[model samples]
Each structure stands twice: as C-alpha cells, then as structure tokens.
Target: MGGIDNQKKFVLDWMDNHAKELSDWHQVIWHFAEPAFREYKSSAWYVEKLRAEGFEVEAGSGGMPTAFMAMWRNGAGPTVATYVEYDAVPGNCQAATTRQEPRKGLSKYAPGHTDPHSALGMSALGGALAVKAAMERFGIAGTLKIFGEPAEKVRASKPIHAAKGYYDDLDAAVSFHPAYMLPMVNTTIWDTHCGVGYNYIYTFTCDAPQDWIASDKYSPIPQNHLAARAPGANDALIHFYTLNESLRRSMLPFTGLWSFNEAILTAGQATADNLTPQISQIDYMLRTDSIEQAEIISNVMDNNAEAAAKATFCKWKKTWVAKSRPGLANHAMAQATYDNLILVGAPRWDETAISVAQEIQRNLGLAPMEKPFLPATERLTSPQECERLMRKQMPEWQRYLTSDDYPDYTWHCPTVRLIVARPMLSAPQGYTYPDWVANALGGIPATIDPMIQSAGKTIGATLLDLFTRVDVLEAAKVEFEERTGGGVGGSKWMAPLLPKDFKVPHQYRWPEYVTTARGEEWTIPYRDDE
Candidate 1:
C-alpha cells in the first residue's frame, strides 16, 4: 500500500512517457505478422532502432537470418541479458476486430501472433529503453544485451545462439512471455519449468525410379503404364507418417504428457506432378519432461524414417532444427522478478477495454459479462501457486511439461522467466470463445497497452535492481552455481544439444507473403481469383 522509491518511480515514469511509443511499435509488428524464419521486416526494424539508441548491433547473429544481437555498455559492470521474439504463428491471421476477420489485403490463413509476440517484443523494448534512461540519469554501470530472436514458435533461434557462445558471458537474464493459462496469468515459472524439446526434419529423396525393375530388358518404355513405377518420395513420406502414427503408443511410456507432431514442409504440395516427386521434407518436433525421454522417442522416430525410406526405395536424411533443455530454477532470481512485478502491479483494464471484450463476445453470438475480462489477468499470482496450477494436470513423476528455448540461457547464467498479464476473455460455462478474440485483443491498444506498460516497468525496475543490488545478484549467482554443479563447467551441467557443426535447416520452403504481378499476397493464394 506504500509508495515506490524514487529510482523505481523514475523507471515507472519513463515507462509512462513512452507507453504510446510501445503500443505503436506493437502495432507495427502485429501488422507485419511474419512467420518463423522469415521475419525480415521485424528484425530489420529492431536493428535500426537499437543502432539509433547507441547500441552496437549485429544484424545476423547465430547464422539465422532473422536473429540478431545488440549490446549497450557503460564501463565495466555486471552483464545482464534479455531477448525479444517477433515471429508470428502461421495460419492465424486475425485482424484487430470484434469479429473473425483477417487483416486487409491479406488472406485469412496468413500468419498472425497467436502468443502475441507483438506485445512481448515491444514491452521488452520499452523496458530496455527505460533501463537505458535510468543508467544515463543515475550514472549506473552495467551492460544490457537485447537479443533479436526469431522463430520462437518453433523454438529455433535461442538454442543456436546459446550453442554459439552468445549467452556464455552473461551475468543474468530476464525473459518475458505473455501469459496463456488462467492460473499463470501474472506469475513466473517455479520448480517444473519447461522441458526438453527435439525438432528434426526428415528429407526423403527418390533419385532413380527406373531402378525398381529391369524395365529396359523387359519393355522399351519405362515411363508408360506398361511397367509399374517405383515408389518415390511421396510414398516414403506417407509410409513415414503412417508408420510413426502406428508406433506412437509404443515409443515411450504413457506416463507423462508427451507429443509428436509432423508438418510437411515440401511434399508434392499444391501441385499434381506426373513425375516421381523427387524430394520431400517433413518436420517433426516432440516434447518430453526429460532428455532421456526425448532421446528414446527420437531414436524410435529415426528408425521409422529408415524403414520408410527403404520400403519406398528412397533415401532419407535427418536434419537438426532445434533442441531445448529443461529449465533450471533460481529461487533468488525468481524472488527478484516477483518483487518487481509486485512493485509494478498487475495490468488493470479500463472501461474501453471492457467494452471491446463485450463487443467480441457479442460478435461471437454469446452473452457478455459485466466484467468481461478474466479475473486472473487483473490480479497477481505467486510463483508457488503458479507452479501448483501448472502441475495440477500432470503426473506426479513428471518434472517438466511443454518446452521453451529460454531454458538454454538458464544453463549459462541466473535467468528469470517473467510472465505478465495479457487480455483474455471470461466465458460462460460450457461455452468457448474462438482464439481470434484473444488475438484481436492483443492488437487493440486499449486492451493491450496496460499489459505492455506494466511489463515494461517491471522489467526496467528489475534490471535496475540487478545493477544496484549486488547482494541480490550475488545470491542469484550462488543459487545458480549450486544448481549446475559448480557453474558452467561443473558436474550435472548440460551442454548445448546441438553439435559443433550443426547446420540450420533453412533451405526448405517456408510459407511467407510475396509480391508479384498481382500484389503483396500470401504465397499460397486462397482468394476468389484462385
């Protein structure tokens, strides 16, 4: 109930002054809505802004085209790091409207921010800028590294950055993700943080269709219906998919919540070719609570790929995409972030925001509530409570669930995972709201600005605390060292899952907006003209 100190006040006031700028930046990214590995415009904008702020910027950091690293320093002090994610999810192109509508001049199935990375990126930027303001005014000494990470939905860039020594020199890290679940609305991860994830692509190739049978000796024409054609890459992909689907149950113990999903990157898609569709690529990403479980499932998948390739007379190769280790908990860092979150308080919605939620409910043909926003978004939830809610649905022995690349930084330095409130609608019993409602709210300034403002202030104050409170930072470091054996090289420490010479799987075709003779349109057209 008391007032905040002058330094924290200064940080909060900085956030207030720049709140509009943050909202506008969020709008820019929401409109861009570029999906994984193709965030050219979003990354360029961040690089330009960081360079203008007097930070040394690296355009392409970690060999990922849309990933970057920027640093601002004030003499010699502790080096703390934070990162931004801008890549939107594919096939979720919802416009900022009460109804289910896509952005103007784009297809309905184009990319949009499902997790609303738009707010996440802008809030972090506002915080970093505010931190810069405090450092300049109070003459604080430290380093701030703002990483531009792309393809976070696929968990792509961070692991690569960590493996390449991007996070090795950090003293601590601050990570922010927009809240998703109800009970975890304004809380950070506790004991069982995100787990291990493995992403790999199986490429099947058919080089010789003629080698299936001695066609030349029996018949002169090998391409006609007179001879049976050899099973090619398409069949290989089908076999791989079906075979994996069949063996999915036997791959691992059905103890914890694990998942295996595949997306066909390139397989006789959008075209019916007479030829043997020479090449096909399918992506598989699975989540498990432990690395040992991940390894078991991955081994089964690898064997399935080989069998499918052999059965279809094709050659198959597995390419590494991403691997994220289970997150390590730092009680000290957690306490620091929660303290700052308390200082900043939860995001409060205005009547205008409530009206917007009601409008969305009406558009969905559902009755609206007097207070349409979910209660959790307006109140704080402690870390312990959040951990309880997170594990309520999991089995007892499972240590982790889902997966996030932020854990990669935890293995290197004391890292804090900050979860802030994002607008979510409350629904009537047995009635569900479409995902577009949340997506639309994320884009509207009235609904999303409060979240951005509070998150920015929390981040600014927390970073300022690390610079000023040596005891807290040291305590976090000690806790981190104790967890990872002795430190980075200590026992029980986990190294980067990626190999030294791992190549990024960027050569495959990914969906993106394109400009042609018609206009700037989705690569796969779904409009009336088609």
Candidate 2:
C-alpha cells in the first residue's frame, strides 16, 4: 500500500533527476553556516533557488524579518505544509569536515552548523519540487505550503506561529530528515520548542539621616568615612545573600540562574561600581513544557522576589519584578507529521543504531555510551548541569529552559531520529556549534566504519517502508500495547525510555561527554567500572 502511486512515481523520478543539484545546494548551505533568525545570505540563496522552481514566495512572515513561505499548486487537493530550516548553531564557526580547531579570529562566539539545518532546506525543497512535478504531470490538483521558520535556537517560533493559527487548514503535512537509515517509521512521539526562560529585575534605595550637623551641637559637620553608615554596610551584605538564597530555593528545578554578574554587563548606560554598593536589580527565567508548570514556576519566582524584598527593605520590599516567555509546549500536530512521514517512507535508526554510534565514538577515543536509554530523571542542577544535558558546544540555556524533573515514567517516545545513508569521515569535537549540520549530513563517528553506516541506512529505509504502509500506524497502535505490556494509543508513547534496566552500549553518552584530544575529536572508551 505504501508503494509509489502513479503520482508518486512521477515525483520520485523528478527527485532522482535533481538529486545532484539538491545535494550541492544542501552542502553549500551547510558551508555558509549562519545563526538563527539572522540568516541573511543563506536565506536569500534559498529564496532565489526556490523562485527558479516556480514557487510564489513570501520573503518575511510571522513577525520574523527573516522568515519566509513558498507555495505551488492549483489550490485544489488537500493542503500539505512542509518546512525548511537553514540556521546554524551559535559558536565554533568552521567549514571543515575533518576535525578543526576553534576559530580564534573573534574574541567571543562563532557560528557553526552543528544541527545541520542546511539539510532540512534541501530535503524539503527536494520533496516540494518532486510534488510540483507530480502535480503538473498527473494534472493532480493540490496545495503545498513550505514555511521557512526562523530562530529555533532562541525561542519556540514554530509553536508561536501554530498558536497564531498558521497551520489550521492543512489536510496533512510531511517532513524528512537526513539520518543513518534511508527511511524508517517511528511509533514514538516527537516534540518541538521544548523549553523557555524568564527574566526578573529588582532595585533598592537607602535613605540617609536628614538632620545637619556642621560641627558640634547640631552643627553641619561631616563625619569620617568609617563613622558614617558603618552598620549599614554589614546589614546590606547579609541581607543580599539571604535574598539570593531565597531566590535559589524558589527557582524551578528545570530553570537556570542567569548569572547576575554577567547580566550587569548589559546594563543600559551604566556599569557596576563602588558607589552602587547596594544590590539594585536582578533577572531570571522559568522553563517548562506545560502551561501549568510554567504557572507554578511563575508563582515561585514571584514569591521569591516578594520574600526577598520584604526581608531586605521592609516596607520598601515593593521593589520586586518579573518578565518571561512561556515554555514551548510540544506540538502534537507536528509530532504526528513526523511520525506519519516515517510511516510514509522516512529513514530512522533504532537502539542498535545508537550502539553503532557509541562504537564510532570509541574509535575516535571518545567516551562510550553510559546507558542505552536516556535517564528518566532529568537530574537537572545549576546552569552547568543543564548545559551538560544539551551537549552542544555553545549551549543556549536562554533558549531551552525546562525543569530538571525528568518524566516520571518511560514512554516509548523517540525524542528525535536520523538515518545516515553515508558514513562520516570524522567525528565532531565536544560541544561544537553547528554539530546539527554534521548530524544532518549523516553525522556519525568515523570509527563506526562505512559498512555500519550503509547497514544502518538499509535498516532505516526498511523501517520507513513499514511506516509508509497505509495501515501500519493503526496496526501498531493495537500491537504495541500487547507486546510491550503498555497502554495503547498515540499519547501512551509519550513516556520516555528509562536508563535503568535498559541494555545499551556504554559509550553512547550525550554530546557533553565527548572532548577533543590534541587536534582530533575523541573520547575515552566507556569504562563501566569507573
């Protein structure tokens, strides 16, 4: 039933003819490596190329200056939406495939294609063009909407658009990501815009004694530095720390503390100095996937502000404040689109694929996978711990803020999946920005060998075929319950796969564990005993 319909045959043929051009376009996009919401040249190039394909393109939409939407069709059949993303992760800017040193040309951050959003644009374009050719050949009438979303690295733009009702009318949507497998269907759910941050500010003012004393007997005499307000100094320091502690306690486990020390660097027309001995202002963010959770987080942040203000300035405790973006709730509709794509011939790698990835890491002298499944508990603590969870070289904590609270139970859900049709010639170094670009370009460790990569793709494609089968989703909905000893339905798959009691390679750890040795990206072999 998943076989190419006469319409699909035409689409596939069109894809085969343009595969080389599409690959070249994707590679160039990878090399350009721009950051989110600021993709100038890359976005322009895509627009130009897309225009050549006969799409009526809108350059900016959704309140984002860089966003775009392109469409082609007779406006007759089911409206299907597809998306293309070309932004790179921030920091570690580079264009080399082999392990390269961090670009030292700048004092601060450099952009990198870690996530490889370049491939997303190419893949979507490829698919859309194929669809266009099919429509023209078979004279089939249908609508295809391709949206170029921006700032996925900074905020949950997609969901914001969805909340604005951008995707309400579509009959179905599809997307394909480059992974180790040619195609595989996943019964598991996927989530987008999973985190957020909130900022808070506070200020304090101290009053001085009013009576003037020049000299003796009510004279307006100035006192020595040590004699004036000495007690106030002691009071201020103790009060500040106490307030800080209260703030810490109030913070949600998933939320992170934005270092007040650093935030001051951005103070408008002002700088931290000796005169401002009294603590003046503060900022913070609360991150979670649930609106209810966010509300709870807000309560905690606000309560902390109030408590701290009261303890310090007494009646002046009124100097408390709060501001924040709501955490990005997972999109069931997008997850359904991802699942359906896999079911309809998208590639994916399974647990074994993760093992192979671990092996690849070891060959590069990288750390081995510690456990097969992601830990059920988030174990989130401090900014440092959350950074470790993301594993990217330049982690944007301000971008994805969530509580350390891991899901209470393991759902069969798959966070993200990829099919690698090609073997990576090298491994990316630790926390490298733009790692997703590498991941998108069949990013796998070189140590795993080309044969494994090829084999993985074979498995992935097979899985995709299964997903593409017309009735597989329905069939799996029933079968998964009996086999896994779990409840049935799409929502049931939301549970995470837990680390406990799960068997997996010791080396397949998250991105944070790997490091660069000498000049090459490598990790120590997994040592369970350690």
Candidate 3:
C-alpha cells in the first residue's frame, strides 16, 4: 500500500475540489428542513445522489420509509461505516437571515434545523464521497457504508437498525454532530458519554362508550333517556399526565442524573357536539445512567398508565419508540480522530464570515467583538479535559449526563463521536444572545460553511487513514474487544435492548407538513398575518 500521508493528501484534495458541491448540498438540505420521520424529500434526494455516485443504495431500510443505506465496496477488507441524520426540530423554524424570521409561507413554529443536521449530514456525505474517491484512485481495499438515519430528534432509528442486524460486521464507525453547549472546536466525547434512554408513546382509546355507563336494568332513568358515559380519553390523558408526574417524584434518589419528560400527542378531537373523545396519546422519554434505573422508571410508568386507563374507563397500549444504550469510550479511536483534527485544524473564520457574525450581534443589539465566536471555538481541548470540565457541573457519580442514540453503535463496534464548531454570535463578555440568533446563524452560508468544510476534510482524512493504515484500525479493534468482552458476541457484551419483533412506531402522529386547498402547510398551519 502507498504511504498514509499520500492517501490523506488525496482525500483532502478531493474535498477541496468538491467543496462548492458540498456547500450547495448543505444549502438544499437546510432549506428542505424536514422534520423527524417525515424526511421524504430529503431521503429521496440523498438516495438519488448516492446512486448516481455508484453506491449500492437500499432505500427504506429497517422498515422506516425515509431511512436508507448506501454502500461502496472494493475488493475485501475491514468495513468502516459512518451515518448521517436529516431530521429537524419541530418549533425552531427560522429563515436564513440575521434576524428572527420564519421561512416564507411557513408557520413560525414549523420545523427548522436547531442543531442543524443539514450541515451534520452533508459533511458526512462529503467525507464519505471523498474517501470513496481516494479508495478508487489509490486501490485501497475496504467497504464504506453511509447510513441515512431519520427521526434523530426523538433519538430514533439507530437502535432499530442495530437490533435488526444492520450494524453487525462493522470494524469501526464514525459519528459527527454540530457542536453546541460544549465550546471546543473539534473533540470526541470522552467519559460521561450519553446514557441509556427510553422513549414510549402510550395510547388510550375509549372504543366502547357503552362499557362506561351503568347497566340499563339498574338505571332509574326513563327508557328513552340517554345514559351518561365516563369522561373518556381526555380524562385518561389528564390522569396519566398527572400520575406520571407523581411517579417521577417518587423515583429513588440517586447521585446520578436522570430525567423523565413527556409530550402530549393526542388530547381530543375537535368537536362542537357533545360526544366522548376517543383517543389520547402521551409520549414519555426517560434517560438514566443504567439499564436498571431505566427499567425501574419504565415499570412505574406502566403501572401508572394501567391505573389511569382503569380509572377513566379506557383501553391503553404503548409503542416503544427508542431504547438506547450508554456510550462506550474508545480512547484509541479518540486519539486517532484528534490527531486528524489537529492536522486539519479548527475552522478559520474569514473576513466575510466574521462580518456576518458581527452583523448578527449588532442586530441583537449587543456590542460585537472582533471575534464573534467564543474563544474555545479557535482552540482544541483533549477528550479527557473535555470530560473533566463536563463532570465539574455534574455529581461525581453521574457517569451519564445527556442522551443520544449514537451510543448504541458503540456497543456493536468502535465508534468515534466527533463534534465540530458551528458559529454563535459574539455578545458582550458577560452577556447572552437569544436562541433565534444562533438558529438564524445556522441557516446562513457565510457562518456555517466553514464548519461543514472543516468537518468534511477531517472526517475524510480519518476514513482514508483507517482504510490504508492497518495498525490504526487494529488499535481501535483491540480497545473494542477489551471493552466488549470478546467483541460483538462476547460474554460481557449486552444484546440489543429491543426485541426482534418490536414494532416500529411509524404510525404515530408525528408533526409533518400537509397539503390542503391553500397548498402545502405545516401541521400547525401558517398564517400570512400576525
């Protein structure tokens, strides 16, 4: 094989040549701004593009209509995979401007890229394509897979794919996200990685209204009179919401951090006439450091759901949306990626980019600095140091603080989680800017392109190194086997937390755009005025 340095240069040069196309791709996805499970157009665009580039594309993998897998193989060797997410948040819709403005002809609350998975996904695409170019040119032997993961806002898809054996046989995996909260320009999460999380949608249906009323034989009312039925699904929903809150308070106190959050899906059908509401759904997600804690929380939630159903005279069922495992750290992989990051360097803010950020700050009525981003964005922090800083704010025993489904990929194979900087407006030293400012910056090309390009180059270089340098791949695999007992089938390894037959919750009433007489509209209809 040729020297690793030559392969790295080939990949970097490929990225440089395709930079404009990558930027355009990022723009299209940012404008698409489709939300979870509803990324139909976005998915189709990716499938077409990947196929055109000679990838063996599988659309609608894992029973998710919008999820896909793209693969390119040359000869035979280690299989390295990287995944992308295209889902946007529900209520963060903002246009690409310095001020807070919704997209033309869309609801102010329509979906937008908050973490801006647009850049996240496009960068991964650029990296994969660049690596593909390198492999073909240099005769590097390996298989590269790019998985299209949808519904990541709800931490969905990855767990399902893993359970269904899509992630099996992977030598290593790379995951990337737009950095927020953590200020580091480029770093992989060290310890205190994301914890186990469970998401479920509990549905209550009042199908048989007659069962709620007393028997006619024992009733004193006239024969022609209509008997009053129970309060129906609305009452069931209220009962569940209240009881869930109470149960949350009753959970055992521990030094580790945990959280239980709920979002109501179905309250009641719109109606003028007096009739019992039929269906109500409440979605609950819990994150904890261990499976034991998640199970405890899950059991209590189930009990509360049953009691609520019994009391309100409704039938209840649950749909498991996501069950994710805590991340397993690979210091070997972290060091390897960090080395590539140092070589690639953090994103350099050109004059135009700096001007755009300063303008954003000026619009926010805050004094703009010469440097619009936090100082941390221009520097690098070791993974160990990042973890130390993160833990300082948490209890000593809190091994898992936040939650993401990427951790599930770690259990199956060595996965490196890379975070790259996305620009944030510079405010006065001790001041804060509004979220819309950051959201607005995410959509602006002048501000976000650097992140996209830098991440693409770094990831592309890392992929090339992994494929061409056998020692680097072996180092990552050795760490993986050590942590996972004996690799995938090891004694200490945990099987997928989900059952093989676990039904995908695609039928749930997730937010999506709709078509009406007025043309396409968000689920929460947009108003031209006010």
Candidate 4:
C-alpha cells in the first residue's frame, strides 16, 4: 500500500475535487425533505448513486423499504462502515432564504431538515466515496459499508438493522450529526452519551363492531341501529392518550433525565357516516438511562392500552417501532477520530457564508454581529471538555441526557460519533432567533457548505486511517473488547433489545406528503388558496 500520508493526501484531494458534486447531492436531499420511513425518493437516489459508484447496493435491507446497505470491498481486510440519515422533521418546512417562508407551493407543515440530515448524509457519502478513491489509488486492502438509515427523527432503523445481525461483522463504524444547541466544530462525544430509547405504536381497531352490541342483542332498538353500537376506535384512542398521560409521572424516577411523549399516528379516517370509527393509532416514545427503566415504562404503557381497549370495546395491538440501548464509549476510537478532526480543522466561513447568516439575523430584527457565526465554529473543542460542559447542565443522577439510536451500532462494533459544526446565526446577546431562521440557513448553500466539506474531509481521513493502519483498528478493537467484557459475546456486552424476527413497522400509517384532488400536498392537507 502507498504511504499513509500519501493516502490521506489523496483522500482529501478527492474530496476537494468532488466538492461541488457533494454540495449538489446535499441540495437535492434538502429539497426532497422526505420524512421518516417515508423517504422513498431520498433512499432511491442514494441507492442509485452508490450503485453507479460500484458498490453492491441493496435498495432495501432489514425489512425496511427505505433502509439500505451498500458494500465496496477490495481484497478484504477490516470492514469500516458509516451510516447516513435522510429523514426530516414535520412542520419545519422553510425555504432556503433568510425569511421564514415555506417551500414554494408547499405548506408550512411540510417536512424539512431541522437537524438537517441532508448535510449529515452527504458528509457520509462524500467520505465513503473519497476513501474508496484513495483505496483504489493506493491499493489499500479493506471493505467499506455505507448504510442509508431512514426515520432517524424518531430514532428508527438502526436498532432494527442491528437486531437482525446487519452490523455484526464490522470492525468499526462512524456516525455523524449536524451541530445544534451544542457547538461541535471538530469533536466526538466524550462521555454522557445517549441512553436507552423506545418507540411503539398502539393500534386500536374496532373490527368487531357487532361484538359491542352482542350483549344487548335483544335491546328495543333494532340490531342495525347505530345507537346499539359502541363508541369505537376514536374513544379507545382518547382513553389511551389520557390514561398514558396520567400514568407518565409514575413510570420513572423524577431525579434522572427521562421522558415520555405521544403522537396520535391516526385518528378515525375522514368520514361523514354515523357508523362506528374503525381504526386509530397512538405512538409513544420514551428515553431512559437503562434498558430496565425502558422496560418498566413499556409495561405500564401496555397495561394502559389494555384497559383503554376494554373500556372502549376495541381491540389493540402494539408494534415496536424502535428500541435502542445506551451508548458504549470507546476511548481509542474517540482519540483517533479527534486526531483526524484536528488535522481537518474546523469549517471556515467566508464572506458569502457570513453574509447569509447576517441576513438571517437582520430578517429576525436582531442586529447582526460583526462575526455572524458562532465562535465555536472557528475553533476546535476536545471531547473531554465538551462532555464536561454537557454534564454541568445535566443533573448528577442523569447519566444520559438525550436519546439517539446510534448507540445500537456501538454494541456490535467500536463506533465513533462525530459532531461537526453547521452554521447557525450568532444572535445578539440575550436574544434568540426563531427556529425557522436556523432551518433556513441549513438549506442555503453558502452557509452550510463549510460544514458539509469539513465533515466529509474529517470522516474520509479517519476512515482512510483505519483502512491502512492496522494498529489503529486493533487498538480500537482492544478497547471495545475490554469494555464489552471479552468482545461480542462478552459477559458485560448487551444483546440487541429487539428480536430477530421482529417485524419492521414501516407499513404503519405515518405522516407523509400525498397527492390530493387539489394537487400534490402534505398528508395533513393545506390549500394553497388558504
């Protein structure tokens, strides 16, 4: 193989050469703005691109139609994998301008990138392609795996993939996210990592509408009378919703950081008939520091669903959408990743980028600072310091502050979570810009390109090192084994929380864009004339 330095140089140069291509890819994804599990167009584009780049692409893997695994190997060595997330959040639809305007001809409730998975996915793509180019040019022996993960906004896909043994063979993996409240210019998560998170959909169906009136078959009213039928699925959904809220406070200790939030996935379908409403769904998501805690919460929620179903004369079925373990720490991988991050440096913003941010501030009626970007964007932060700062705000008993599914990858193989800066306007002292301002900046090329390029280079360099430098990969493995007791089957290691045959919940009635008689529109339906 060529010298390590030469390989690194080649990868960086390749990334620079393909900068525009990466930017264009990011733009396309940003424009698509597809939401969880429903990212059909976004996943198709990635699969097509990966295939064109010579990777053996699986358009859908792990039973998820929008999830894929793309592999490119050269003579086999350590397998290094990176993942991409393309799901956007609903109600974040905003144009790429400084003003808070939704996309043209789309409603404000349409999905848009809040965390901006567009940059995140593009960075992973750029890194993988750059590393592939270097591996071929330098005769580097290894395999590269790229995963297209969908529904990340709800912490979906990764757990399902890991449970089905999709991530078992990897020597190491890398994950990335755009900087939000935290200013992670060039840093990896230190400690205080994410905890266990669970997602479930309780589907209440009134399929046996006749059963409701079975006990009163001899009532004075005729059997076909609407009054004889029970209050249907809508009542069951309301009871479940109210009962779950009432039971939330009893699910976990208030001392630690834990939460339970619910969303009504489907209420009764639009109907004017007096007939009983047939179907309804409610989704519940919870985050806790340990799997035990998550289980306790789940049991309580299940019980509530049963009671609600009985009272409302409906039958309910629960589907596990996501179950993620707490993050595992790897010092060796973190140090190696941090070293590469320092080499790549922080994202550099020029006049064009700064002007866009300043314009956003001005539109928000706040005076633009001389430096429109966050100071952290121009500096490097150690993971240790980042963790220290993060922990300071967190309560003493809270081991994990937030929830993310990436931790699932850590148990199977050593994984590094990389955080790179994305541009955010530096508001005037003691003032805050509305969320749309940040969302707007994420779609603009000038403001977000620095982050995309810097992250791509950092990821590419780190992946290249693991491919060529056997010692670095071995060191990461040693740390992984020690932490995981003996390794994959170690005593301390935790198995996937999901069952192997667990069905993927992509078929659920999730919110998505739809075509209506008025024209194409969001599922919630917004009229342009309104």
Q: Number of the top candidate by TM-score?
A: 1
Count clashing residue pairs per candidate.
0, 60, 0, 0
Could you tell me the TM-score of candidate 4?
0.94
Q: What is candidate 4's lDDT per residue for 226-336, written digit by digit as tens? A: 356677899999998888877776554563678888778888868756667889998888888888778887898899889999998899999889999899999888889
What's model 1's overall lDDT?
0.86
* TM-score for candidate 3: 0.95
Model 2 whole-model lDDT (C-alpha atoms): 0.41
Could you give candidate 2's per-residue lDDT for residues 70-160 as a string of tens digits? 7776655555566677776544454333343333332113465554566656666666666666567656566667777654443333443
Q: Candidate 3 on 253-335: residue-level lDDT in tens?
A: 64257888887777777873456778999888788889988988898888888999999889999889999888988888888
Per-prediction RMSD in angstroms? Answer: 1.6, 14.2, 2.7, 2.6
Error of 2 at 393 (Å): 25
lDDT over C-alpha atoms for residue 45 of model 2: 85
Clashes of 1: 0
Q: Find the 10 residues in a row with the least total lDDT in model 2.
A: 406-415
